[model samples]
Target: MVEKEGFAALVLRLRAEGISDLDLLTAVEQTPRSLFVPPQFAEQAYSSRSIPIECGAFIEGADLAVRLLANLHVKPGQRVLEIGTGSGFIAAVLGRISERVMSIDRYKMLIGAAQRRLDSLALRNVVLRQADGSNGLTGEGTFDRILATAAFPSMPRFLAEQLVSGGVLLAPLMTGEETCTMVRLTKTGSRFDREDLFEVPYLPLVPKVASFL
Candidate 1:
């Protein structure tokens, strides 16, 4: 009962802050942030703050996910491809609203942990995989929405190609030598129209799977 009230409070706060999407708010309210948070960071799970997870990675603040997903404009019956699955929090959110969610991460440890969380919630639409996040899941076919949790210097062509026509890709890119800012790209024919969202620091999308992790 307390948990329900806590999430309700969060949803109201986010709505007051202009995150008015009902689906997004409901997903946030229904999904237990604790499921994706480490036991040590459980207290911070529902806050708009990033918290450390396993494999030396940190899940982004819930506020960031709200902003990113708001711009991603995910909808029912859409397929989402998520790069850098991390704790699979975003992937789980995508799964709640989208038809299918294919999330990949370089660290097997992270994927394994995320799988457990998703399974606990019975989020069967979300498929967590341990693979090179930067590889773009070449043969996995196309997606209606593509979201990369990791940042890159620029939108990689390989990842962009996986999007179907009129699809949207949300990712953070290096705006300057060392400055990273997230952007939204909408695929139109052979080109994409870019829209700068906000600046947020993110780990670079590195190539190859972590055989050691």
Candidate 2:
């Protein structure tokens, strides 16, 4: 299992790899990955890999998650919405940066488990819910930033309505016949400016709250 020394090494490695946002890295460092990883995967908590959690969902590769968050550029005091709240690790880290984070998952069991993880960490700003998480968060009001862990066959243009004008949405979207890539959509006056960030491994967004755990 990775210990304190491994975490320090990870920060140093992230720096060495040109992830220049020290504040973001600090937040990542402060948020222990082990707390969110399932017991069987505890030893992989600090590795640069995706850790499986409850409900057959996964936390993306640690470095990949950081890259996406870096592109999202979540600022302090901003309201963030996270779709597919897998292990709740990203939301917890975002909670440290943003004023509040509303994370939703299709799997009810994932939400309950993730909420417990957030509570244990004393991260009260993050709220987890079992919802479709496709486009209906408007009830909670628009967010400054939105990020999705699941992939969509196309850019979820409908989400623009759920974003504050000028808000940014980060997601993994299908680019070709069978490939998925991470992209950022910036709201721009009734339109969106799309930026394809990089390729990422992600599952399709599944609608409906799972009835069974």
Local error of candidate 1 at residue 64 (angstroms): 0.9
Model 1 over residues 1-213: C-alpha lDDT tens digits? 545765766677677778889888888767788788888777677677788888778998877778888999999999999989999889888899999999988888889999988988899999987887776887889999999988887777788889999999988897886778988889999989988988887877677655556
In candidate 2, stretches whose alpha carbon ends up further than 4 angstroms from where it belongs are 209-213
* Candidate maximizing lDDT: 1
* Superposed model 1: Cα runs more than 4 Å off: none
* Clashing pairs in model 1, backbone N/Cα/C closer than 3 A: none
Q: Write the per-residue lDDT of candidate 2 for residues 46-86, one digit (tens) a residue.
A: 77887776677788877777878889999998999998888
Best-performing candidate as measured by TM-score: 1
> Pairing residues by index, what is the TM-score of model 2?
0.92
